[model samples]
Target chain A: MSANPEPRDPAGETLLSAAELEARLQQIGRERYHSLHPFHKLLHGGRLNRGQVQAWVLNRFYYQSRIPIKDATLLSRCEDLELRREWRKRIEEHDGWPAGAGRERNEGGIERWLVLAEAVGLPRDYVVSTEGLLPATRFAVDAYVHFVREKSLLEAVASSLTELFAPKIHEERIAGLLQHYPFANERTIAYFKRRLKEAPEDVKFGLAYVIREARTRAQQEQVLAAVRFKTDVLWAQLDALHHAYVEPGHVPPGAFVPEGPQEWQASA
Target chain B: MSANPEPRDPAGETLLSAAELEARLQQIGRERYHSLHPFHKLLHGGRLNRGQVQAWVLNRFYYQSRIPIKDATLLSRCEDLELRREWRKRIEEHDGWPAGAGRERNEGGIERWLVLAEAVGLPRDYVVSTEGLLPATRFAVDAYVHFVREKSLLEAVASSLTELFAPKIHEERIAGLLQHYPFANERTIAYFKRRLKEAPEDVKFGLAYVIREARTRAQQEQVLAAVRFKTDVLWAQLDALHHAYVEPGHVPPGAFVPEGPQEWQASA
Candidate 1:
């Protein structure tokens, strides 16, 4: 009966001031980040058991594996060589150079993640296979990849702006795991420790890119929504984990069956 | 260190009998369908208040609108015009024939869904705009379209086997809604009324296609996996709804917030 409403802009609203925009962005991060999720609280507070922690690591590896692929998609679409030069570093950081392309072979984030997965007692091969992922995990992470591929370049960069809020979660995660979980150590939880080093640089580039480019209120709203969408992406994964693993009898068929209470005693 | 494991067939396992395959498919549906989701249980049992029902209608409208598009994608890929001819009827059933076509204009499923939405007190304009949708709803529905687009033809067709299990849910939905809710009129719930007539033929054709064509054990497994994936697609949408709406205080920042408990006391 009615048409799709055109995004109504008021008569003469001006662009957001830089300080105001940054504050609003920070406000979104502080309120909506996955660090606030109860599942994360359980994990970081050492309230989760061994299998519950393994469920998180195994399911999370799927997300970790896809990051470089998403970055490559970003690089393919970018027109700026300088931006591409900066962005491609992300791909190598996730997916190390394959021993040949005129670069030294070194480990990347994905291998580091597998090491964490292995340390957490998920077989590295099983982690790589991704056969144990929650179905929602696949849908949520694939949705992120598609969002990067389909949304505007600005939104793609903006989605990664969740990194602006990542350092604190990483710091807490490292300390909590080290303090509580037995499998966790300086070496076992190296990925989070390394992320303290990697994520800030990513956040700096992504935050500045969005802040500089999202000039109009409409574009700024899209940036905010993208950041929100990314949080939902992270939050949804934890929701699936909590529903399937923490909550009894809810995991759909074929998802990983963590050995909680009965099968695997509380070893962690 | 190891190869991607070839799907191991036990040394002497043979193709399943058609009856066994059908039973397995039914077993999957029994266990995994959206009818089993608590959100649907609450909905059919008339426990959700006005805003909660409105949230369901609004978010589900996005999925309804995309059905014809996914169906069209399936038709475009089918080399068999016979299959295309059969599938095009589905597109018309959802999208409806235009007024100028030789056939008299009859309302299709999407418009009928809007009417159901209107009957439940959501303004048709708001439902049409779909600005109130859960981000997970968009991702899950869009993933269905992508699954149809990207998977093999048999798998694409097989993903639709959820329809095999749909009629019972539709029957229950129609009966439950008419029995429990105030807005129960034959005209208002016409969408589900129509689907009971439409889906059986679809199930017949699709069932035969998978059973007749999936001659080998491996192909049968793919069919089974596709059906399970489809179930997850539907289940994930409800999981999102239940997480955001059924559970208190978990709705993401921009999703539809239903009037329930304190705001709109139980008036269903």
Candidate 2:
């Protein structure tokens, strides 16, 4: 939205200063992140019902389950030991180290996500199997994986900067879920509670890497586009969710359906 | 919506009768096709202005132009000469044969689509280049291509059965576009008018192929899921359009933005 002719140089400078680049990256978050999506607002505002929430948790597990693989794809592509060392921690966080192994966190995000799924009264096997994921969920998550695997390393790292915006959503989610849903205790929503801490750590490294690496004007443009693409990946999942589970609800064929006493009554 | 305990084998039959299968396919269309999407309703009912209609055409061109490529992928995977012979016509219809090379139709759907794009006032090259497509558009179309490439042959064929419902929507679209938009004369809307005659040819073959090949309950289930998947591909594109162009529009960072006398003033 800036009046600058060059998209990369908003200030019309030769190269963006690190603070400027970081500001642009944060601007992408403010303008495009899924937390700003209506579904997210509905979610954090506690406007959705249990079945809708359950549908979200179930579909989101597809994305949550794929993070480690996306990280692993990034790790596979990078040549720098220092970057790899910092990045390997993300893989471990999502996929967890072995039980007896000396890692900071032994229980991966996926396991914790399943815990939340069980708390939502979904069968654990169904959530873990991802049998009931929306087609949109699968496509969006797979796009993230392929984007990391295929895009330039700078772009890949930049895409991960959505994590830059994740902690606030996590905080809001924990508060909203606990206040509104009976299932939202520390044990069930621990995944988000942990993400409040973990995302900042991950994005700290990812943000700095993209800012430092994307030096050229064209590279900066790619980095910006990458972040935008990531935001779409996240936002599209919610669009699908809102369409299927929200008002005028036409749940897509073969997706999760709430059982037992009709938990979802479309709010008029 | 059926109360059957088992999703498949509703009658405890080994396989559905062809009539029964056709009915089920139509049912899927009634419930899930993009025709039922709010965007579709908006477009057909004259609720959307020219800019929104242009956005739909432009984004949809991404899907429109890729039909041949998707068909060729299906053709490549198929070993049956009869099936391949039938399928290759789809590619020819979208991409067209070399001018005067003796193909029935020289101007393909893609060219016809550009006519629609021009009628709507988008620059022809911009629509053709697909530079303005939403990330959601690219991802959803790419997912369809991948679905055809990777799924079982029968599933690929089954996904194409969304065309079964196409003639009706095309008829409705032609009527609505002609009635509402001044630019909707036959010359500008040739794409839909052409599809009215062409889609039945495609779906007639596609439907029969699916019913014949999906001989087991399990195969029938896969066929059903494939159609559902196709509907999601379509419904997701409109969701992207509606979210980006409709009320409280948060057009994702780098997607299409309508230019010219700003016709879109978001409804309160």
Candidate 3:
């Protein structure tokens, strides 16, 4: 197989109208994104044994910690105040307000994410510091930042269209976790709850921005490509996790290793 | 492992003196660079049969095509004309001049590399277009370019210190290819012969630049780290190739596959 798919007859025809394009984008998420990834299914299904669950939470914390910074990078690059103001909400959502504003309420998404980490039995410092996340996770996330920095503004905005499909997946994931994991509860899953609400607004703004702005066929194609790249980013992380924690057990040296029965106490 | 190694101990004794650092860096190349990688061993040892060698040349062309562009990026960023002039030689060495007074009669390293591609049965147009290279090769090479752009100048120069070790590897690779592959001869291996002389001068300039500029202990460590990062860049390309082309054969969906019979075709 060629590393890239044979260039389809991209010029053949418009496969979908604007409305259909939007649905096709969502369909891509339904079929290909992390929610459908086997590791994620195993995660939400509670089929992952305890060690696998620990691995998921530990690896995911790396992604969570980088969200605000990635958003802030986007925030830094936007010249228009309207765009900046809209984007600032994402950073604010992750970072919350400074202490003692009385407005400085409970912790933000990052902190809530830590609660999920603790619920899964990972140490707070290790989780917060992201000391043991997979290298593939770091590489994938860095690739996203590079895309945003290097690609056109339309494509950068389009890449964030992953948010468009997020609310639905967020719903499924939360419901699945609650149904399957006794350790998971409404309180522990608060991060997904907030995202379920936040994602729709973000996605609505971003999709409108992309649809209106991606004027040329090439630009429209880039929009689709960006979302595809983002999907791969999410999918690759799960693939690495499955390869490491599930089949064949050929984890790279220095990645997280689950402690066996005797070693479990020492790690604990 | 931690994506980044922990900061080295402040008081850790020096592993190599200034001169010894040069020797150890060369030693690392001797033991670990891609020339020593099993994929190269197969290619140079005549063990790959034919289609595999074509795949090797096709994938490697991506690396060859990027070197001058990477050097040009480094040149563009340097403020000093002397530094730029010194660096410009690398670009010239790889790209050659375009029909000018000092222009060499032959095409550049890129053109020479295509001879290997032709010898191994890949079309020159396909090789030059780089449509067939692995995604991992592009990612790794781009990562190296970004590293040079973002790093301190001393560290950036240090990254090219890999050249210091390249001469030995080039010699070994050349001899190995000539002895083992009946289709490979002086003309087919012209690229390595050019690199044999070019790499040492480039290495000397880079090493002296790094040693003279890396005054503090922290800066020295950064230089060392830069070399290691560059080594990883080269190492990862081979790792990706090995995994995709060799054992387990779980080639990613669209990567290149050998066509027709496995035996070498007689050169025209």
Complex DockQ per candidate: 0.44, 0.34, 0.15
Q: How well is each residue in B102-127 modelled by candidate 3, as lDDT tens digits?
A: 75575778888988898877888888
Chain A only: TM-score per candidate: 0.90, 0.90, 0.86
Of the pair 1 and 2, which is ahead by TM-score?
1
Interface RMSD of 3: 3.9
Q: Which ten residues in a row have the lowest lDDT in candidate 1 chain B?
A: B259-268
* TM-scores of the candidates in the order shown: 0.87, 0.81, 0.78
| Backbone clash count, each prediction separately | 0, 0, 8
The 10-residue segment with the lowest total lDDT in model 1 chain A: A4-13
Top model by TM-score, which number?
Answer: 1
Provide the fnat value for model 2, as a fraction from 0 to 1: 0.41
**How would you encode candidate 1's per-residue C-alpha lDDT over A39-123 as one tens digit per residue?**
9999999898878899999989999999998999999899988789989989878876667768777688888888888877778
| Backbone clashes in model 2 | 0
Candidate 1 deviant stretches above 4 angstroms: A1-13, A97-105, A211-218, A260-268, B1-20, B98-104, B212-217, B260-268
Tens-digit lDDT track for model 2 on B11-118? 565677788888898899988888888888889988887778888999999998888889999989999999999999888888766656564546888999999898
**Tens digit of lDDT per residue, candidate 2, span A129-164?**
888788778888888888898889889888888888
Clashes of 1: 0
Superposition TM-score, candidate 3 onto the true structure? 0.78
